[model samples]
Target: MTIREQLDALSAERILLLDGAMGTMIQKFNLSEADFRGNEFLHHTKPLSGCNDILCITKPAVIASIHQAYLRAGSDIIETNSFNANAISLADYDLQDRAYEINVAAARVARESADRYSTGAKPRFVAGILGPTSKTASISPDVNDPGARSVTWDELEAAYYDSARGLLDGGADILMIETIFDTLNAKAAISAIQKLLDERCSADPEGAAAGRYDVPLMISGTIVDAAGRTLSGQTVEAFCVSVMHGKPWSIGLNCSLGAERLYPHVAALSEIAPVLVSAHPNAGLPNRFGQYDESAQTMAGHIETFLKDGLVNIVGGCCGSTPAHIAEIARIAANYKPRKIPEELASGAAAKTVLSGLEPLVVDPAVGFIDVGERTNVAGSRKFLRLIKEERYDEALSIAREMVEAGASIIDVCMDDALLDAPRAMQKFLNLALADPEIARVPVMVDSSRWEAIE
Candidate 1:
C-alpha cells in the first residue's frame, strides 16, 4: 500500500510505536574492528569500529536481526540504520564515497524485515533517518570569526540528495530528519527532499509520476540542556516555527535531554505543531560514569505521562534503549489515545503562516514550493532606475504592481547603486509602493548592498 494510505490508517490508532535505539543494540554484538570491517576495508588505515552504518553492507545479517528484534517487540515503524549514511558523517572514517551503497543496503535490510513481520492489523514501516552531520552548518569553525562556517549550503544540499536518493531507492516508507541540533541544517535537508519530490513529479519517465519519496515526512530536534533550547539557541517554539514550513507528518524531540527532563519542551511544541507530535527521549539522564541509569520499565513510565497528557502520537527510546524498552513502550502506548489535532487545523484553518504581507501561505503536509518575485530591484532593472531617475514615481510603481499581478507572493526591493542615493531612493519607492493596495498585500524583502541603506 502507498505510505499515505498507511499514515491515514495509523493516524486513526491511539499511537504509533517507533523502534528503540540502533547504536545501543549494535553494541550487543561483541564485534571488534575486524568484525565491523567485514572485508569492505580490510586494508584501510582508519578505524571503522564505531561506523555502524557500514555494517549494513558488510554485516547484513546483524542489521536485519536488529530490525526483527524491534518488530518482535511490537514496533510499528523501524528506522533504517542509515543515520550516519550521508557523505558528511562517513567522511570521518574516510568511507565518504560509499554513502549511497551504505544507505541503500541499510534500508533494504529494514524493509525486508518489516515486510516479513507485517500482519493485516499493524503493518511495519521503514523511516529513512537523515542525521545531523558531525559538522554544524550555522556555526563557525574558527572561533575568531563567527560567520565562517565549516560546510556550505550547496554541500549540505548535495549530501542530503545522495542520502534521500539512496533511501527512496531502497523502499523507505518515511523520511525522518532526527537528532537535529541546528535548524539551518534541517532546512537544507528538507529543501533537498522537496526538490527530489518535485523532480519525481515533473520528470516522469513512465506515464505516471507515481514514484519514490512519496512517503510521510517527520522532523525531530534535540533539546541540549535545561534551558529548553536546541544547540543552535532556538527555543522549542522557535524550532517549531523554523521547521513547520516543511509540513512534517510528525515533529518532536529526541536524544539530548532524557524523557522526564524533556517533558515541558514536548508539551510546548505540541501546542504549536499542526501535525502529529512524537518523542523518543534518551534512557534518562546519564550517571557519573556516563551510562543511562533508567531501566526498561522506568523509562516507559516517564513516557506514559506524555501519552496520558495527550502530547504525543508516536513514542520510542533513543540512547541506551533495547527491545525490552520498546516492548514496554508499545504496551503503554496501546492503552492511551493519540494526541488529538486541534479542530481549527483539521478543518483547514491554518495557524496564519504569512510571508511578505500577502495572503497566508497554506502549508499543507505535502506542499514543496513557495514563489517570491525580485524584479522590483532598481539595481537589476536599468529601465526602472531610469524611470525613478526621471522622477516618474507613478511609472516606476507600475513595475512593482505588475510583479504581484504575475503571482509573486512576496516582492524584493533593491535600491543599491553606486551613483544613486540608495537610502533616499529606497525610502521614496517603499512609501509609494506600500501605499498601493495591489503591492502592499504581499511581504517585501529589503535588499540593499550598503549596511547603512539596509539599516
Candidate 2:
C-alpha cells in the first residue's frame, strides 16, 4: 500500500512504533568505528556499497535480522537500515558513487524482513531514511554566506537524486527525510525528489500519479544543540514556515535530545503539524563514554508524556536506542490513548510559524545595529588574503570563525583572484558556515560588482 494510505489509516488512538537504533545495534556486532568508516574505500569499486561494512554494507544478513527482531517485537513501522545510506554521509568512506546501490539494498532488506515475518497482523511499513549531507547545516559557513560556499544546489540535488531514485526503486513505503537542520538543504532535497516524481508522472500515458510511485514524504529536524532552534538558527517556528512547503505527510523532531528535552519541541510541533507528530528521541542523554544507560523500561516511562499530552502519533528510538526499548515503548503506546490537543493551543502554535522570506535581521534589544564585521568579506582579505595567496583554505576557515564571533551577520567574500577559484572558494566557505550553528542563519549579501564574479 502507498504511504499516504498507511498514514490515513493511522490515528492518535494507535501510536506508530518506528524501529530502533541501527548504529547502536551494529556496534554490538563488534565493529569498530574505523572499520565502518572504511566502507568509504568502496566508492571506487562499487558506488552502491554502504560504508558501514560491519552491518548493512558487508553483512546484509545482520541488518535483515535486526528488522525481523523489531517485527517480532511488534513494531508498526520498521525504518529501513538506511539512515546513513544517503550519499552525503557515505562520501566520508569515499562511497559517494555507490549511494544508489547501497540505499536500494538497505530498503530491500527491510522490506523482505517485514514480509517474511507477516502473518494475519497488519503489514509493517518500510520508511526510507534520508539524513543530512556531510556538510552539516548547523556548522556550514555557507549557511550564512551562500555566495562564499563550495557546495551548490546542483551538487546536492545530484546526490539526493541518486539516493531518492534508489529508495523508490527498492519500494520504500515512505521517504523519511530526518535530522534536517538547514531549511535550504531540506528544501533542495525535497524539491529534487518532487521534480523527479513529477517527471516520471508526466512521462506516463495515463497521467496517473497513483500507487507507491507517489510515496508520501516526511521531514523531521534535529533540535540537538539548540534549545528549540536548528543549527541554522531556524526556530521551530521559522523552520516550519520554510520547510513546511509541499506539505510533508509528517513533521516533528528527532535526534540530539532525550524525551524530556524533546517535550516542548514536540508540544509545539504537534500544534503546528497536527497531521502526524512523530518523535524518536535518544534513550537518554549520552554518558561521558557516549553510551546510553537507560533501559527499555526507563525509556518507556518517558513516552507516557506523548500518550498523555497527545503530542505524538509515531514513537521510536534514535541514538543509544535498541529494539528492546522500542518493544516497551510500543507496548505502552498500544495501551494508552493519545489525547487531542485543544484547538486554541494548536491554532496559536500554527500562526507563529508563518515565516517571511525577507532576510532575518536580528536587531538586538540592547544594541540597535547589532554587529556587522568587514572581515567577513575578504576572499583573501588580510587573513584570507594570506591564506588564499598561500593556498591555505584551512587557515582561511579560522578567519571565518573569528569573523562570525566578531558579530558579522553576513560575511563579504571575494575569492576571484588567481589563488581563489570563485566557485570552489564559495562552496568551501558556505560548507564551513552551514556547519557552524552560531552564524548559520545569518543572511549573506553578495559584494561582487561583476555579474560573472557573482555567478
Candidate 3:
C-alpha cells in the first residue's frame, strides 16, 4: 500500500503515535559549538551554537540516531529535525542561503531512519517539520508601532516554498506545520504547499489526476497561555476556522501548555474540527528554571485520559518529552481506537460560510443577522478617516472597539480616502486592529474598491 493508504489503514485501526521532542532528545547529546559548526562552517563569521536545525547538515548521523530512537520507542510518525530550517529562522546563524539544503538534509535523515524500521505490517512515516518562523507577519515587532511588521507575506511564502520543496524532494510522507503561534504565518505555509501542488499538477497532469502527488498536511498550533488562545490572540475555535480552508489531514494543539492544561482545548478541537485531531503537549509546565518536571509515567497517565475520552486520533509528546515518554504513550495508545470523523462533516453536509478575525463568525440563517460595523471605514466615517491621516491608530481602534461593544458581530474596515495611501493605510489599520483583542474578537471585513488594498 501507498504511504497515504498505510496511514489511513493504521489510523483507522488505532491512534497513531507521533514521536516526542526532537529538541529534548538533542539536548541529551550535549555537543559543543564546534560540533554544531563542524567542517561545514569552520570559518563562518556568525556563531552557530544552539541552532539545532544545523545538525541536519553538520551531523546527519546524530539526527538519524534521534529518529531511530523515536522509531524504536514505537513512533508511527517521526518529525524531521528541520523545525527552524526555514530562511527566516536560519538567518540568525547566517545560514539563510542554505535553508533548502538544510531542510533536504533534515528530511533525508529522518526518511532514512524511518525506512530502517518499516515493515509490511507496520510501516513508519516522516512528517516534514515546518516551524513557525522566528518572525510573525500578523504581529508587530515594535511595541510603539502597532502597524509595523518585521516580515511580509511574500517573504514568508518564499521561505516556506523553499523549505516545503526541499522536504518533498527528501521523501517526507506528510508536511507537518507545527508549533504555530501566528495563524497568518501558517496561512503562508499553506499557500506555499498549495503552490507546490499546483506546480506538480502542471508538470504531471496524468499523475496529478491519478492522485499520485497528493500530500497529507498536519497542522498543529500552540496555546500561548492559560487563556486558551494563540499568541496572535485567537481562541481554539477561531484558529480552527481560520485554517480550515486549507483542508488539513489533522488539526490539534501542541507545545506551551502541558496535557492537563491543554486537555480542554484538544477536547474542544475534537468536538468541532472535521478533520483528525492530534496533540503533543509538553511533559508539563516548566519549572522556575524552565525544565519539564512531569515523569514519563505521569505524562502517559494524562494521555490515557485523552484516550479514554476518545479525543485524539494522534497522540505524542512535545517539549521535555523523550523516547521513554513516547514508549509509554505508544503502549497506552495501543488500547484505544481513533476518534471517528463526524458523518455530517465527512459527507460535506455540515459545510458553512465561516469567517474569522480573532474569533469565528458562522453565517447561518439559524444564527440570526450579522451586524457589520462600518464606522472604521475611512470612506464612511470622517472621524475615522481623520485618525488615519493623523496616524492616530489608537483612537481609530477605540472606535472599532466601541462598534463591537455596541453589538457588531463583524467590523468593516476601508481605507479609500483620496488623501491616503489606501493599501498601506488598510494594512496598518488591520495590523493594529489584530493586535487588539477587544476589536479582533469579531470577524473583519476589508472593504475596498481597490483590489490591492483588499489583497
Q: Best candidate per TM-score, number?
A: 3
lDDT of each: 0.83, 0.70, 0.91
Residue pairs in candidate 3 whose N, alpha carbon or C atoms collide under 3 angstroms:
none
Off by more than 4 A, model 3: none
Stretches of model 1 off by over 4 angstroms after superposition: 205-213, 354-455
Tell me the lDDT of model 2 at 35. 49
Q: Provide the lowest-lDDT 10-residue window in model 2.
A: 350-359
Q: Which candidate number would show the highest lDDT if scored against the true structure?
A: 3
1-455 in candidate 1: lDDT tens per residue?
Answer: 56777776787676998999999889889879998988877988899999999999888899999999999999989999999899999999998888988888888999999999998887888998999988887566776544456886678888998998899888888999999998778989999999987787677655234544466889999988897867766677767777877978899999987898899989998887788999999998878987787999999999999998999989988998889999999888889999998888666575565342422344344665656677778768888878877768788889888988988777888887777888777766776664565876566789986886665
lDDT of 2 by residue, 317-403 (tens): 888888899888888988876545457645555333233221245344554554545564564356666666675665666666677
Query: Total backbone clashes of model 2?
Result: 32
lDDT of 3 by residue, 1-455 (tens): 55577788888899999999988888888989999999988899999989999899898899899899889999999999999999999999889999999888888999999999998777999999999999999888999887789999999999999999999898898999999999999999999999998999999999887776788999999999888999999999999999988889899999988998898899988888998999999999999998898999999999898899999999999999999999999988998989998888777798888888787888998988989998998878999999999999889899999999999999899998789999998888888888888888899888999999999
Q: What is the C-alpha local distance difference test score of candidate 2? A: 0.70
* Order of candidate numbers by lDDT, starting with the best: 3, 1, 2
RMSD of each: 9.4, 7.0, 1.4
